[model samples]
Target: MNKIQQFWSDFCIVTHKEGIEYKDAFQFGTSADWLADLVVEGKKTATTSGYMFYEFENEAIPQTGEYYIVLNGLEEPVAVIQIQSVEVIPMNEVTEEFALAEGEGDYQFWWNAHEKFFTELLKEYDKEFSPNMLVVCERFKKVYSK
Candidate 1:
């Protein structure tokens, strides 16, 4: 396989621990929606609750670290744990041809992958408890690199 194809394959392996079936397409919005829906449903029992999305900016990709997702219940903030590393594959790997072939199955794969990624990251970080958190894949692009 070419570099791009190899990278794509590796990325899929990392994202989908169970192994990708070549039909999965990573759906971005669905994961966010899933978290939002969870919060909305949880609020009925917990009373006031909400979630916010934060974006990270830097010349290089960030390493996994603690991020805050402010909640009405807490005076401080709810932590959304992350594991950032340089292994991030470029966005171009998800080309039109690949996406078309993968179809909607990729979104399902991503949703499941995000869940596993966050769960595993939390374990690696040694977080005692799982909070209402959503793990996001931040695709970092360099200004000069093509």
Candidate 2:
């Protein structure tokens, strides 16, 4: 197995041995390595993504109480986080409080960055950017780190 595969294998073994339940594995931003570091440091506690992307990718919405293995930019396992809550809201409805939970920067910065990120992603599907686009807002707490 490759290094990434081995990491997950080891993690599964350890978690199972300790009787911890994990639901799935995923990485942070496409190129944002710092965000993963923030998660490891227990700074970033929430994330948001385009709801359509999840549908397009055929991925399940994260559930409360589900444990997720967080990977870094290098696709290396960095930390484990448990989902606390998930809400689906329009992009324009995203609030300052939720932006603060992202731990990237101030509210405006988060808004701008996420808008750009989602805009680009939607382009692949020939979708136009819409201020009212649906987004999945997930709140999580770090449970373990490497």
Candidate 3:
């Protein structure tokens, strides 16, 4: 498998999520050296959302709590997500057959799921903000925090 595929496969194994999905959603003009991959396990709380997996070259790793704006093909950011923490598992931690036989749809589903999760968080915390912008802004804040 190619580097991208191998990295993605390793990420999926670490995340323990199925239905590997990918999109070229990194910011345009971003270095091609580091490959960012996101994985969603089963549903998670707003705070947890799902698991996000990223792989970089030369052992470089993103700082914890860093956020990223994931864009779709239209160049529109569909979601703002953050890296809560970083962990390094042995390459052997990932098994073979990481590729899925079927493909999931776009990242929109991820956005929507995170939105719901964040909304629940707001409700629990009693925060104030327009529901519409809350999702975007919250995500943006998380992304820019890095």
Candidate 1: count the clashes: 5
Candidate 2 stretches with Cα past 4 Å from truth are 1-21
lDDT of 2 by residue, 59-83 (tens): 8889899888888877778887889
Instruction: Supply candidate 2's per-residue lDDT for 115.
Output: 87
lDDT of 1 at 37: 34
Residue 95 error, candidate 1, Å: 18
Better model by TM-score: candidate 2 vs candidate 3:
2
Q: Per-residue lDDT of 38-129 in model 3, one digit per residue for the tens?
A: 22221211221111112212323444555444444444443434545443333222112211100122345434444565456456446432
Output the lDDT of residue 144, model 1. 12
In angstroms, what RMSD does candidate 3 have relative to the true structure? 18.3
Maximum-lDDT candidate: 2
Clashes by residue pair, model 3: 67-143
Query: Which ten contiguous residues of candidate 2 have the minimum total lDDT?
Result: 15-24
Error of model 2, residue 63, in angstroms:
0.7
TM-scores, one per candidate: 0.23, 0.87, 0.28
For each candidate, the alpha-carbon lDDT, in order, equals: 0.30, 0.85, 0.33
